[model samples]
Target chain A: MPEITYRDAVQKAIADEMRLDDSIVFFGEDVAKAGGVFKVTPGIYEEFGAERVRDTPISEQAIIGTALGAAITGLRPIAELMFADFIPVAMDQIVNQVAKYRFMSGGQFTVPLTIRAAQGGGGGFGTQHSQCAESWLMNFPGLKVVAPATPLDMYSLLRAAIRDDNPVVVLEHKYLYTLKGEVPADASPGSIGEAKVVREGADLTVVALQLMLHRALEVADKLADEGINLEVIDLRAVAPLDSETILRSVMKTNRLLMVEESPRQGGWGASVASMIADRGIYHLDAPIKRVNMENSLIAYSPVLEDEIIPNAGKIEKAVRDLLAED
Target chain B: MTTDSIARLDRDARLKALNTMTTIRLAEEEIQNLFMANLVRGTTHLAIGQEACSAGVAQALRPGDSMTCTYRGHGHALALGMTLRAMMAEMMGKASGACKGRGGSMHMTDQSIGLLGANAIVGAQLPIAMGAALTAQIKGSGAIAVVFFGDGATNIGVFHESLNMASVWKLPVLFICENNLYGEYSPVRATTPIDDLAERAAAYGMPGVIVDGQDIEAVYSATLAAAERARAGDGPSLLELKTYRYRGHSRADTGPYRAPGELDEWLKRDPIDLLLGRMIAAGEIDQAEYDEMRGAIEKAVVEAIEWAQAEPFPELEAADDYVYYPG
Candidate 1:
């Protein structure tokens, strides 16, 4: 099926997991032989040479503490952070050493480590290289985060965040890296806190992620030609937040909305509207609208970056103001 | 005596470096009497007079080499062999700990003896021991790592981005530093402007040296000549050592900004009384077999603090076991 390009499905999910894990490797700043400044890692440093695709030193905390010290001594690495707004120059190697080294070494270390980074907003690289840093990494809990809107979930969630043992992150979306799709040359990966629902419709739900899940599927295909359908979903991994498929699509679309692109203060759509108002608030009939972006600063000017980011006409006006409050 | 591992320190490697510097000075005096009987909680940082830079860089590494120190690492986790009842059951937090108590005592890990932890942060274990020496220079695994910091993590920034990416990837790694001249109390000439922190390893071109860190054969001959120039791939070196920290950066910091006879001048270089006065003047032990090998290492640090204070403290639903990686 090879129709590729979410930057060739993140360079075929990191050259198909460094050709089935020769314990993975890869590094950052111009990921080797000067390929990735968003060239996504061209020819993986001429097919994994320079000792597994090397090239580092722009040292974001020694590229995430040498990918949490080569994932606790065995080596899985990956690293890259060319810009997830330089994750606060490596927030103490991703919140105190790759999320507290396997719970403060209690499990004696497992950090298979992946990292990647690029993040969202639609280029204009303003406000510290555009924004959406998956709500500054879903507030930490040993970091998983994901974010791929498609070239098949960026080749199955970056081959499930480089075969997840733990420290994941990924992000991508510098405007869905050339978008495209088809994928399947062994695509697989679905569950890092699942949430696909892609289109369906009972008249509301929405949710969104990465380029606001393609502007909530172009506002659910132009509100399914006025019959007002909607549904959407696509979240893909904001720290295991499937929230049981957005509370079973808000108990048959009783109207949720969210949509984001960062900044409704502490966003991943305010933890999916505080987990659907703490346990799908009587299976939502309204009050969860979100639409986000204005916490300010994006501004490079594609009309002040499309007047504060959201779009598909602000998810069809927050899905017609939550289907006119049901 | 320059790197034939300091004329191969024999006499049972100088009485196993005076029984690993008297089991790291009786496990930092039983982790300062288990933090004065409150049986250890938060802050500890001891390295009591540095124990010959963790018994001379864990006697020049070896067993699939790996390390990463600081939080004044209980003398590099008892010079890399770990045990003393899994570091006093992870400084008494228990459940048979070397991390079963979820890494107490500034996160000490054992990783079956490679001790891949002990980082309370300062210089963040030199980019995770330069990423475990770039995983032994990409799994040709002649393994080498060694980190240890201090001299206030040489004014950190991931210690100059882990020594400029471990000397532009010659990797393997050794870095040491233990220049305990005081980072936690502010002494290395008022937060170091350089009275030699091994000349910041010449802005990362490696080979820095400066040892005598209370000697353990001059830090096992400059960490066995920088771990054989990082297992012959020739990279990373910065040794430093120049030790001291008889205490005070944590738990009862009697350091009172020491200047008054600077703790009797580093307690007159007491690295286990200068290797038991050079194994009792080279006649090899005599103060009655050095008081029966320090009364059997203080009866094995008082039976590893009464078997880590009769163990068991972890089961609060195992505090949601190791935060992640369960699958």
Candidate 2:
């Protein structure tokens, strides 16, 4: 076992995968010489060389489209968009071309590509550079979206996404990059559409994704002192949602609290809550509770940002309120 | 560049060009009838007048070379040697189609014949074609990618991006702009300031050649030279073929843009008819042979129609089948 940060886990996964498969190449603004804006791809250029670890121009559309082409032509490419908010420039490639190619081509081609971008608002990067758009991508049918909240999960999920035969969007929360945790040395590549239960409890189940997963776990620990059993599940992948695991947790705990960092409207929490309401409604003893950011652009100021996003206190309060219901 | 060499193509190549154009024309004509009869669904952009561009460019390409086309792609697919039966079946939404009926008329693709795919989105194929060419260049496959687009694609930002990238990277690609004078009922003059679409390539520092698209010999010569340059790793070239489409932009168009006299004048310069006359005057074939070729083409067209009509529709559950790998 090794204590590694989430950023190091991602770097290790990319390095390991690139070592195993020569076809796995990386490119983005400052990803090569500068080691990526977030340093997730640090020192990769020295080991892999400039050809494989490429530095591209600031054209996001070209970055995505070229990666897509390379992916379809037998190379596994991991493209880094500097920030998640800048993904709009490349949306045509991601949404129209990459997402639909496999389905539109009748499965003749596979887009084995990973688009990694730093998401979430906590670094005072303002509205343009911050914000989580995982829900917007979830609206598309042919894409797989993933967000790993911990070091071990990041390592395993990155490996899994690289091996997938379809396009995968890995959203890295900028706030969780340096967060450290114990990661197993020989952790196997994990499945895409499965939820990992971080903490098991009997009273209430808290379903959280990305950065909010850690918050949920913190809330669960805090509520444990009050004799309230709180379970926390990290939804690692979003598109091929692990509804079964979430519903089974609801069936056991009989209470649910969904958490996400995206806007409250059409967020990952809304989808999770809807899934539970549709299939696991009868199993629930109380209505599903959701904890998400307010439906507004993330502000730059620390106080305003904190006011907009959901926190551990909010999760703990939401869980308490759900438990208080009849 | 010599006229003597240009005239030495012999009778077979000439007849083949004529035959290819005639096949495309007849197939599209049959498609029009089928569409009118409610047998074919979705939009069909018939390339009736632009046959020489497809036939000549397709002839210039080697068997393993690749092609990407715009939504007006029936000609490209047919010219690339896809069986009329498969194409018609695709247009009719039958399982026997090239894309298993998933890609209707606009998106037909046959990888076996090097037809990468016909994209419905304008200028979208530019980057994809450049990528294909890059793949060919990297693999040292000697396979060049030819992208066929209409005059309207010149205005799209992706077109410029692709051209610039191709020029900078020196990718083995030939960008063929079929300047049919209109972009969905709107004339090119209304939108474009420059009359010559080939001139746009000047921005990328690539050689741009404008050819008489009605003349199959002219198109063949220009494309052959461009293909040679690409194969030689001299970078991509822009070949703008000045042509027109006899039919409307799509099936729903009544084609009222052109006057009756204009239609009649353009019809007189039909590529198929011009090639047939040249072959006849050169003693390439007798009237009996010509009539026999015509009769055979008609029979093939009818058989293709019958095959499409008799083919089975795709299964309902299979809609999601090809979206990803089954395994």
Candidate 3:
């Protein structure tokens, strides 16, 4: 009934879940009085008291470790690491402990925790503050990684991650927080490991994750003017990849193009490409092309940063090259 | 509160404490033999001289309360009522083990017994214990979480984070640090600037108590008070058990770091012997009864080792089986 911004949708999802479940709590540096650096947690402390909406000390290791501890014990804690770049300090907890607890315990335990942080670079935050680490987390076995690009996806995915039994890493694009989209009034929280086909076409399938999905959609619209139809698939979740949906699309289009904001080497796009090559290689008429960030640190300068990341223009050109091949 | 209270314990509680310590001692002896005989694989950290802390604390806990332990966790697991057979089987990598042989000696766990796990990483269990306490608080289960770590863990950042959160939320947790004075090859003096680990708790605005870890009665009394305060929701307590480890940090360690006379000094204060002396002096048990208890525990330990050696290793294909991806 009402159009909400992506930031508001995230806040509403946490507020609603906190209302429904007393075990749900939020904690991060500056999250309490500041309501999050991006304001995604505004009014949460006022609504849920200080205990539920905790403001933790400036320790990423503790932020993640405390969340893991709280999650495994009983409470559902959504811990925010102020920025995605700061996650390296807590990688041991996220990768070794939180990700391996279920498997290590032979399914005897579950780490029902959610780690939310803003990712991506567009606001000239420099190399240290701007990073997309979803691919790094996807390498682990017991973790579920998600990055929501739209208001609807953000709300539904955040809610799903909070409710899931396994540990989840929700990478919210810092640049997309203010973007608005139409969300259904009564839309139920969506499932993990499913891809959403935002635009349908017959020529080629362009798979994108997080904010790149919006760029892919924009490129799909531009390519339509030239009578070149393109199918845009949004990879809502990374770890439990929707291989079936991706294969089905690849079988129809016979060409694949994956775009990601992470480094090209060992990026999540590599996994998708390898999956298609392994399962649906015979369905392809041309090679699968990937558009990703350069395999280097993000530059501090805006011009250099822009050149490092993949944009709609690059996705469009990659699709055209793949289609041009006989 | 009084010296008489320090010297006195209920008959059943004293027996339970002694039995727990005996179980852990025998279990460690069995594990050592099995490890040397090549029946069990992987590194092992034995809690031989540090039995009092685990036994005393575990004896104070109810069935529903939970515990998180460090690599030196055989005592913790055995004290929490995890069958010696399961623990031995786990070390031997058998499917009959508590974690279905997925976890080894340092990772032993029995959720049914409220033993969350024996984490290998130092100081890693602090936050986890806090989380479990948070769970207990939220569910109103009246349960508490006891975290067992070493003096070495005090230097780790997770230790501070866990303490801060535990005190801030007043979560039902008992942060027990077994200050054995050594963190692997390095002694605590070489690593930390503080003389007393208990004093560090004062920074977090909670009560910190240091007790004679080699005395079972002292450890039991201190832990009981801490557990009672936790259950009453008074807040978390930091109990520093001043103890010593008879063995090296791990199997690979030769323990050359200790002075020549330190081991003998600690052996004089053996917790099991102290408990036995008290029991005998009070006429709680005769020499014959003590011999029978010791014999039974020895028999159990022998059977556990035999069972573990007879067990088979897990199949290689099973390695990737439990990597969960909830579709």
Candidate 4:
């Protein structure tokens, strides 16, 4: 096993794929000369040169739109959007053009393009800079949405996304860029629609994503002596959700707590909660609980940000309440 | 349009251009009739009066060149030599359609003919065309992608963004803006600064060309020059064709927003009439030949309609197919 940063894992995935196929290329705001804003793609420029690794203008629409067109004509393009919030600027291309082209073109074209964006609130960036756009992207059919929480997951899922014939959006959390973990020497490429049970238990099931997954695990570790056995499920790919895995856990544990960083309403957390009630309600012994942001904006101040964004305390409290109710 | 280009056209080339213009004109007219009779399932933006632009540019393109256009792109598709039967079937939502009934009029595509698509979203295909050109540039394919859009589409963010990026990257692309005086119902004057839409190309450090949409020869010359420049690695060019569409925007609304006698004024410069008159005056095509060509087109369109009508509807369960590969 080799310890690697999540940032390196993503860069390696792109670099490795580009080496395998000359048709693979990437371009975005600062991906070439300056690597990337978050330094996720730092050495890609020196390695791939300017032709394969390009630095585009400050036009998200053109970045994604050109990739869609290039993908149509025998090229695999990886478009890096600086931040997820800026996705709306290219919504027409992403939603209408990129998502529907496969179905609309009647399979005449396969979009082997990967759209990467850094999302989630942590760096005190304003509202425009930070946003988890999984829900909005998941709404569009013919799009594969995958958010990896660990370095290994980042490398493996990115490979899966690059190989998938459909258009894939890889949402990487801003906070997890530098997170270090032990990734196998040849990290096994992951399937996009699969989920992982990072920690096992039979008492309660806790489903979380990105930074929320870390918080759920932290709470699970602290509650071990308190007789709380928490089963932690990491939702790697939110779209084409690994529902069978979550449902199987719910059927055994009977209690579920879902955590998310986006706004409470219409967020991924709401979808998970609905999925449990819609299908797994019969096996539940307690009500499904969701610890989410209080339906408010992620403010700049550390105090206000901490209040809105869920944390280990919130997950622990939610788990205690779900257990005390019985 | 310079009369020199039309005069320079040899007899055969002149007749072929006229044939293309007439086919586009008749096809759009037939689509209108079909829509009125409820034979076509969805609405279509007719390119009746703007046939010259599609005919000229598409004819100018080499066999390897790529093209994409707006929703009002039946003329462009026909000009690219796509089978009228396939296009008609697509618009009618038949199983034998170009896209197998999944994409209606707005999203018609056939990669075999190098026609990427006719997108419904305004200005959406500009960047895609840029990408195609980029791919060609990277692969040294020596192919150029000509994207056809309208005046209204120019106001979109992607239009300007794509132009700037294409010019900056020196991608092999030609942008064709068919200024048909309106974006749907709103006249171009109200929506855009109509003085020199082509001048925007200068901002991106590329050449801007303005031509008469009613003049097929003028359009062919301008597009041929642009495509040549792009293939030579001189970068993209913007060509704004000043034309007009006689019909309203689409099938649903009867366009009543025109100025008094506006339709009549534009109708005088219809491309089909312009080409027919020029070719007839030059003895390249006689009255007898023109009548035979038009009669042949009419007969072919009837056969296409008959084929489409006889084609079975796609299976109901097939709607779920192709949402993803091997789904």
Candidate 5:
């Protein structure tokens, strides 16, 4: 096992894949000389040289569209849009062209493009920079979405996304970049739709994602001290969800709670709630609970941002309330 | 009168260009008739008055070169040597069409012929074209990529972004703006400030040229020059072909926005007539030879329509396929 920060794992995953496949190309604003705005792609330009690691203009449309063309033709392009909040600038290319090409070309083509962007609500990136837009993409059928909660997951999930011949979105949370974990050299998380049970328990299933998974585990530790065991499930992949794992957990504990940083409306949490309501409701003794970012623009102040989004205390309160009810 | 530049392609190539332009005209006319008869289920955007641009650009490209176009691109797909049967079937939404019946008139693509895909969005294909050029540049494939968009598409942000990207990276792409005077409903005079769209290329540090798109030889020569530059790694160029569309933008548009005599003025400069007039004047073909060529083109159009009419629809079971390559 090797310890690597989530950021280093991403750079390693890209380097490993690029080493194996020459068709892989990386580009975005300052992805080259600046080594990415978050320093996630440092030293890659020196290793791969100018031809493979390109620095593009601030045009999100061209970035996504150029990658779309390259992907469908022959190359596998990893495009970075510095922030998830800027996705709307290239939404036409992402939602209309990139997502529709394969289906519209009638299976004649595939856009093997991976667009990476950092998303979360904690940072003082304010309104323009802090947005988790994976929910908007989840509605589209042609795209595969994944958010890794650990360095190991980030490495394996990205490998799976690049290798898969589809338009996959690899969402990196800015808050989780510095978090480090021991990653096995041979770990392969398999596909973009698989889930992992981070902490198993029989009391209540607490499904979480991204940084919230860490928060749920901390709450699990605290709740354990109080004789309230919490089963923490990390939903590594957001789209093409691993419903079987979620359903099994709900059936066993007869209690389910989901937490996310996206706004409640039209977010991943709403979708999870809808899924359980559709199929897993009969297995749950208590009503399903979702702890999500409040439906408002994330405040510029760090204190206000924390209050709007979920924390360990909120998770504990929600779980205790669910257990305290009938 | 056969412009010496196009005549340089020789009599055989000149006839090929003339024949393609005529076939496109006949095909579009048939499409119009089909729409009237309630036969075609897809929306039709006739390139009736803009044939020379498509034919000329297609003629300049090598075998492996890639191309994309706007919704009004039946002429482009046909010029790139996509089978008439496949194109017509695609227009009619049949399984035997160019894209296996998935793409209709606004989205026809024939990969074997290097026709990437025709887009419905105004400037959506520009970045894709640049992407193709990026691939070619990286692989040293010696293949140039070209995108044929309308005058209106030049206003979209992607157009400027892609042009800048292609310019800085020196991507082997030719941004051909088929400036057909009117962009759907609004006239060019009413929309863009500059009369010539080519000059905008200067802002991106690329060579910009304007040609009388109604003149097939001028288009062929300018596109050949641009393609040569792109193939030689001189980067992308913008060519504004001042052409016109004789009909309304789409099948449903009657085009009342044009001046009362504007339609007649542009019709006189019909690209097919210009090419044919040149051929007759150059002693390449007399009236009898002209009649024979017309007959051949008409026959081809009829056969394509017949083939399309008999083709089957795509299987419904495979609707979800190809979204992820299934691999």
Candidate 6:
């Protein structure tokens, strides 16, 4: 067992997989010599050398397309975008070329590429750099989207994403990079589309992911002392959602409250709420409530950023309001 | 009109090259007839006049080498050795088609022949080809990646990004731009500022050459030289083929926007006819042999259409297949 930061977990997962598989190559801006702009992947280049771990120009489209090209031709490539907001810059390569290549080619090809991008708002990276863009990619059927909230989940889920035959987008919350947790040496490469019940309680089921998961957990802890029991589930996989776990939890708790840092409209929470309404509507004792960021550009000020995005207070209020419902 | 390049090809090589160009020409013509008959569901882009570019480039590369072309890729797929039956079946959306009817005219693919895939989006294949080259570089596979696009694709941001990255990494790739004088309806001049699209290669620090696309020998020679350089680990190069499209952008476009004599002017330098004239001038074959070869090819193409049309459409449930690999 090792206590490691989420950032180190990502680096270690990539390094460990690259050692076992020569087919795995890492490419991104300043990821090699400069050790990544986030400093998350520093020693990989030294360990694997320039061929396995390489730096790329600031061309997001080329970075993604090259990863795709390499993936289809018998190599598993891991591409890192410096920021999630920049996902739009390479949207065509991701949504059209990478996502559709397998289906478009009638399964003649496989794009086993893992695209890692630092996402979420809190450190004041401004509108262009800070966006929880996991929802943007969930709309596509061929793509798998995962957001890891803890170091252990980050390590295990990323390894799973790399090993996946389909293209997987891993959104690492920027604020959680330094947050540390005990990660098992042989953390199982758990399957995607699986949710982790971080805390189990009886009163209500609180679903969240990435930074919002941490916030909801904190809210659940505070409310637990106040005689309110909350079952908090960390939705690690956003696409092909772990709806069974959610519906089962909703069945028990009879209430569902989703917390997310993305825009309210078309957010991950919105999609989950719609699904719950469709599948588990009769089981829910109250209307499904969502705590999401306002549909506005993330601002530079920390106050405005937190004000817009979900916080522990918002999660707590939503939880209490759901319980107070007749 | 005899150059040292055409002389390099012996009588058999010359006739084979002519046959490839003619096959592509006849196949494209047949596809047009299929479209007119309402057999092809969506639109199709026919490379009727750009056969030399496809034939020349395919001849230059080894069989294991990879290639990707634009939506107007019927010529490239045929040149790369995809069966006429598969191409025709794909156009007709039959289960026996190249992509098993999952992909239509725009997304034709035959992985067996190393035709990576044909992309419908403009300039989308550039990075994918670079990636394939990256794979070759990593595996030390000696294989190269060739990507073809229209002159309009050169203006795309990804096109520039792919070239810069490929050149920076010394990836084994050939960026072939078929400057067919138009990117859809607009002529190159109306859309692009530069006269020669190959000049864009200098910014990426790669050797960029312009070839007379109608001349199959010239295209083959230039591509072979570039491929050799790539195999030697020199880097990527951009090849601009000065060619034209006989038809409009897609099936419905009648080229009303083109200059009146533009189609006629390009037809005068038809790729298949240019190679045929070269072979005939060198006494490779007489007009009778050429006619007989074309007739046989036309007959084969017609039969392929019949076979493809007879094939069944894919099961409706197949839409869910291959979205993700079970593996």
Per-model TM-score on C-alpha atoms? 0.43, 0.95, 0.95, 0.98, 0.97, 0.98
Residue-level lDDT tens digits of model 3 in A146-259: 988889999999999999888889989998988998888876788878998889999999999777888889899998999999999999889888898899999999999999
Candidate 4: tens digits of C-alpha lDDT, residues A191-256 = 998889999998999999899999999999999878788999999887888899999999989999
1 versus 6: better DockQ goes to: 6
RMSD of 4: 1.4
Query: What stretches of model 2 exceed 4 Å from their correct place?
Result: B1-8
Clashing pairs in 2: A103-B323
Per-residue alpha-carbon lDDT of model 1 for A1-326, expressed as tens digits?
66877888888788888988898888888888978888888888898888888888788998888779889888888888887888888988899889889988888789999888887776777888887788887888988888878888878888888899998888888888887879777668656778788888897888887788887887788778888887788888888788888888889988887878877888888877887788879877778878887687688878888889888887787678778885
Q: Write the per-residue lDDT of candidate 2 for residues A87-155, one digit (tens) a residue.
A: 898888888888887766556687898999989888899988878878889988888999888888888
Q: Taking the tens digit of each residue's C-alpha lDDT, what string does model 1 give over B14-133?
A: 888888888788878778877877767777877777788888789878998989888778878888888888888888788888888877888888888888898887888888888888
Order the numbered candidates by DockQ, best leading. Answer: 6, 5, 4, 3, 2, 1
Query: Candidate 3 — which residues are off by over 4 angstroms?
Result: B1-7, B308-321, B325-327
The whole-model C-alpha lDDT of candidate 2 against the native structure comes to 0.85
- The lowest-lDDT stretch of 10 consecutive residues in candidate 6 chain A is A290-299
Candidate order by TM-score, decreasing, is 6, 4, 5, 3, 2, 1
Please state the interface RMSD for every predicted structure, separated by commas.
10.4, 1.9, 1.8, 1.2, 1.1, 0.7
lDDT against the true structure, per candidate, is 0.83, 0.85, 0.86, 0.88, 0.89, 0.90
True contacts kept of 4: 0.76
User: Whose lDDT is greatest here?
Assistant: 6
Please give the DockQ score of every candidate, comma-separated. 0.34, 0.51, 0.61, 0.75, 0.78, 0.86
| Predicted candidate 5 versus true structure: per-residue lDDT over B1-327, tens digit per residue | 124544355788889998889889888898899887888875789989999999999998899899989989899999999888988888788888887777788898877788889998889999999999999999999999999999999988999999999999999999999998888899988888989999999999999988889988888898988888999999999999999898888988989998999889988999988888888888887878878988988898899999899988888997776666777
- The TM-score obtained by model 5 is 0.97
- Flag the better candidate by DockQ, 1 or 2: 2
Q: Give lDDT tens digits, candidate 2, residues B1-327.
A: 334434335677888888899888888898899888887777788999999999999989997788889778888988889998888888888888888887888888887887777888787777777667766766678889899999999998777777877787788999999999899899999999989989998999999998889888888888889999999999999989989898898999978987668778888998888888888788888788878888899899999889788989999988788665544
